[model samples]
Target chain A: MDNNKLQAKDFITIGIFTALLFVVEFACGILGFIHPYIVASYVIMIPIVGSVPMMLFYTKIEKFGMLSIMSVLLAIIMFVTGMGYLGAPLIIGAGVIADLIAKSGGYKSFKKTVLSHGVFCLWICANYFPVIVTADSYRKNLVDGGYSTEYCDNLFRAINSKTIAVLLILCFVFGVIGAFIGKAVVKKHFEKAGIV
Target chain B: MALKLDPRTKLFMIFIVSAVVMMSATTPLLWAVRITMTMIPIFLLIAEKHYAAALRFIVLYSAALLISFKFLSENSKGFLSAFLVGYCSIIVQFMPAVITAWYVVRTTKIGEFVSAMQKMHVPDGITISLAVVMRFFPTIKEEYSSIRDAMKMRGIMFGGGNVTDVVEYRMIPLLFSCVNIGDELSAAAVTRGLGGKVKRTSVQELKMGGADYMLILMFTAALVFFVVFKYMK
Candidate 1:
């Protein structure tokens, strides 16, 4: 709990939380593979599932830089797994700002945690940025490789249609939703765990 | 040969190569480099005597490429094929990182990794958090299996399972126990003198050597060549 020292348990809490985030992500991946039709569902579930562990993490660490450390670690993992290097910067930046907001509420403000989580959720969409930006090149690669014109155009258009702004707003709405749900779950079930 | 390189260098190179693969518009030369970069992992896995895993990577990568090619060339249109194509491309793009991660994780010892981070002057927050990342997953795996067993005994099958049933019965309890684990682990770490004010030392030898420098130089040259080719062409 001490910001200055950050005993081993604090780091342990951060580590487990990071792994939990990844586990939820892995669960989401399994769902996507099984129900490819529900890829869109992932956009919502990604934040909510991730935030479940994160809300508990925030509740326990209750200090500065814990979220930042966890975010950086998760970002590194995401990058290493080929999600995108873009996630690294986006996560670290969003994490720091989120940490600041949480700090403003003295790390106990549930409202601040919710707002911070909403901001933090934006980074999860970093995986899409490369697809959106390179949609044209991907189209070109397909077309030049003897793909049909319609298929190429349709694929490119599909990716291009979802601009960055649209993605962020979606994350914001869902992030708030996810955070509130996590808060309720934590309060109800994890109460005896003492995090709440 | 890359096995001799420092853990820090492997991590740095992976990040650099992954970013390049993600960002490029795919000129001919870049494609050549991407193919070669993808193969490095396979070779390293082979060197590490992981023959089965290495063969598996080759088969998967080839399969993905074939699938993408087929989808791209298809005249009939639907979101399903398009989605498959998109996903295939993503898999191919991320393959190098995935392979490299596999190699690093399989080859590097935990003590060596911690020492490597210490040598890099990484903050305790990050280093200790990473140590935790290292320990957490295997623990989770054990706990996960037991939870599944418990669910089976209780007749808690999913598919027809209710959402609240999962949230109430499965996730909450799993999270609750994980929290307890975290507390015990942290206490164990503290008693072992982790998070001390003074500098900590480890028995792991993690210094950069000649191979590390050579690999760094080689990657740096390749990067320079890519940049020059990108602009000059």
Candidate 2:
């Protein structure tokens, strides 16, 4: 029974950090859209791009359920705004796992922080899963929503193809690389500013 | 008198619409919904006296809706088709929902919303964070513009500069300030005793008036009809 009660300050901290998540995520979204050609691949790089800010945030707010609530809110907004549906349920599991990892080192250990974030990055893959795996339902929703089946089929066929396995594997590989980079960036920048 | 639907009512409308959009409820219903959803933003903007903006939004939404309908009905092939079907179509689908959300965010004061949530027995944790999020986004927009201006003075062009350099210069400083401001906000919130265990009260009256109830009733009936209709068909 983890009975740690959050205070007003904690809520404020949560608010700020949640907003920060949106801020960084929104910034990255802009970059992804700018190139147009790399947008698909850029979507894959989001967890890596987003992990930099998450590093500082995780260190600053190490309490349980902090990341969980953040993930849930972000995922819900994403789903509602037509971003991804699978992210919400998938995030709850990832949030708990990340929380456990952070708890192991009392959140102060850099190695634990890096590892926690590495696992946390897995939530980024949730949005892509339905597109890649349960693609029929994905197509069904669009068609149901007034899009033509022909369009949905043509559009998603490449993603629904076998390259999906490669995409999933690359997600983990990027997670490892991204978390290490996040760990480094936190030390290099945030620590000096005492923001972390 | 101009319509003064309670913030909660507005939320309920948005919520049901979102659910309909999410479920992809039924095709005939969805055709009606697409038009109805587009009207929400128009009505909201007009209600707020944003005449020009309302006109612009309706024009763009209608145009995108038409473009999507045209392309989608065709058996599109290759990247152009893929992009239109995959990307543009999604945008077209989400436009009304996005615009409705934007309207709600723009029109509703956070104080009223929190009070409404309180009346609805929302946990303080959720309400507090929601309040904070409501406050923080506009600040970020302000911060973003200031950073852009500062970068402009320093010869860091967003459009022309090296992409990585632009990101580093732009994002790092934004994150830095965000952290600093976050700390400051926490400190301020603490001073105000925002995290206290007692029930927080608000001056705003969250009245579920007759009109509100009527609207909710109608919405529920329509939703039920659609779901049943989908099953029957």
- Most DockQ-accurate candidate: 1
lDDT tens digits, residue span A12-117, model 2: 6677767766766665555543333343454356667677778767776657767766666667566645554656776667777887888888878878877777
Task: Give the per-residue lDDT digits (tens) of candidate 1, residues B1-233.
Answer: 43665788877777767665665535667767776777876887898789999999999887887787566555535656655666676677677777887777777777778888899899888888887887777788888789989988988877657776775576776787788888888888889788887899998777788867876786677677777786687
Predicted model with the maximum lDDT: 1
| True-structure lDDT of candidate 2 | 0.68
The list of candidate 2 runs beyond 4 A from truth reads: A1-3, A27-43, A83-86, A129-134, A137-158, A161-169, B24-29, B159-161
The lDDT of each candidate is 0.75, 0.68
Among all windows of 10 consecutive residues in model 2 chain A, the one with the lowest summed lDDT is A33-42
Candidate 2 RMSD to the real structure: 3.6
Span of ten consecutive residues with least summed lDDT in model 2 chain B: B19-28
List the lowest-lDDT window of 10 residues for candidate 1 chain A.
A33-42
Instruction: Give me the iRMSD of candidate 2, please.
Output: 3.7
Clashing pairs in 1: none
- Model 2: docking quality category: acceptable
Among the candidates, what TM-score does chain A have in each?
A: 0.85, 0.74
